[model samples]
Target: MREEIIVSGRNNPLIDPLLHVWHWEIPVYLFLGGLAAGLMFFAALYTIRNRENNYKVAVQIAPMFASIALILGLGALFLDLHHKLYFWRLYTTIRLASPMSWGAWILMIVTPISFIWSALHIKSIFPNWDWKFEVIEELLEFFTKYKKVLAWIMLISSAILGIYTGILLSAFNARPLWNTSIMGPLFLASGLSAGTAMVIWISKNHDERKRFAQLDLMIIGIELFLIIHMFMGFLASTQVQIDAANLFLGGEYTASFWIFVVILGMIVPAILEGLELKGYKIPIVIPAILVLFGSVMLRIIISYAGQASRWLY
Candidate 1:
């Protein structure tokens, strides 16, 4: 006979086997944040590379979606906050060491810039778009004049935002499932892949769509590589990380993560896109939807699984 007692935090849900404090809000926010980051990253990348004319949807149309996604993500994040009103205090000072602080500042800058970039292209989306105020008109000109600078800012911030989504979890060292640094790059690659799939689904130009599909394929490859690398690293590391890895390898999350995220979300999309590139008539929307679906599932699974994992166990 053996008896053991463990004492962690006073009243932490992560310490409790049956309770989850994060709920759906954190996962939703993570998905949306990653999606917004990926969308804006591509938008800024093409704009900087002078491919705006070539990739109209990536540069002009996607930023609007990114802005909307960011706002919705922020709303989800706010809803998940334990103390919502004190959220404003996060902006009172800059904390370089905290991923949450970095995320807050990045969102503050990237969110408005996404909206501004989208607004600058309002004429393209709505030919008769009107400026309701003189100040809005003036602001548009200033943004247009310094659009290159804005793109640079977006590129940097969006990358940070993408990585921050994963870093946020990795920072919680108690959760072995997310305690690895590889989590950041893996999330970024997944987000970028999702973003590219979105542009492929929305673009009207066949050439543009085809080009982005190729790019998406490349990113998907990288994302897959990162996923495998993450598990390999975990298996080779501590017993705790290995336990965490087992949750996806052969445990309860195995089927969902592998089927939804790995097979349907990534491999299926890659095959469809690959066939499309080879002159097949596969509906781009199918692959796009699968990718988006997988992205959402990935975040949700990670959030819940991380909560289930603890050092005390």
Candidate 2:
């Protein structure tokens, strides 16, 4: 005799359970991408302005970090790909509909530009380095001569790269939490904030550090507003969107979402920076470290929270 087994659909949740498709590499990539874009953007802006302090950390050291950060971020992305050996296929064709395609092209364009941007400052960075190599001298001379043009290109590319980081996640309509158009601007603001904090951390010039600290405070304010608006938009959206929003508000990710991202990441950093701006001699490193750490946590929380969200029940 054969026995028949039946499965009860009614006992299961309405929608398929959220799958953990993405992992730590993705969020780390996003955070580093944003940081790199921010550094490049600020560096280009300072170059264009021909600021007297253009050779400061923001313009000099930051671009080098931008290049390094982007390389690491791309490495993380490559590792996340299942077909790592076939990664070259991404360049073989253009798919307008695919965010991954857009990201790959953007990174390809941005990476070389970032390296060239850093090369422009190589002479200033390593004043004692040997310049006997013709190739190195020529590359340096070319970048220095066309610095303005390169700065403009970097400015535009940085903005695109920063916005692309957000759009990459937003493109996933399957995750309502990441579907909002606001993600682009929000991430851009966060990137600028984190980048500003990073420059502040490494900057030796007192005035420059103060200026960046003020800028970061404003960016943090904007980020906070965007966060509020994001949740408000979710509340006004469909049932699926509301359910997705709850994943952060009252679901599994609630504690880390509030503690790590909202409080420690944005609010505390804002207060610390604010105190410093108010003539209080707070340790700049403290806030800078908090902002950078918060930036990373924000990306991690968003990545996991988005993965936990779904459009259907």
Best by TM-score: 1
Estimate every model's Cα lDDT from 0 to 1.
0.89, 0.87
What are the runs in model 1 whose C-alpha is more than 4 Å off?
A: 1-15
For residue 177, give model 1's deviation from the true position in Å.
0.8
lDDT of candidate 2 over 36-94, digit per residue (tens): 98999998898899973743889888889889999999999988998889999999999
lDDT of 2: 0.87
Model 1: number of backbone collisions: 0
Q: After superposition, how far is residue 152 of candidate 1 from its true place, in Å?
A: 0.8
Shift in Å, residue 50, candidate 1? 1.2
In model 1, state the lDDT of residue 261. Answer: 92
* Model 1 Cα lDDT, one tens digit per residue, 89-179: 9999999999889989989998989889999998998999999899999999999999899999999999999999999999988889999
Model 1 error, position 71 (Å)? 0.8
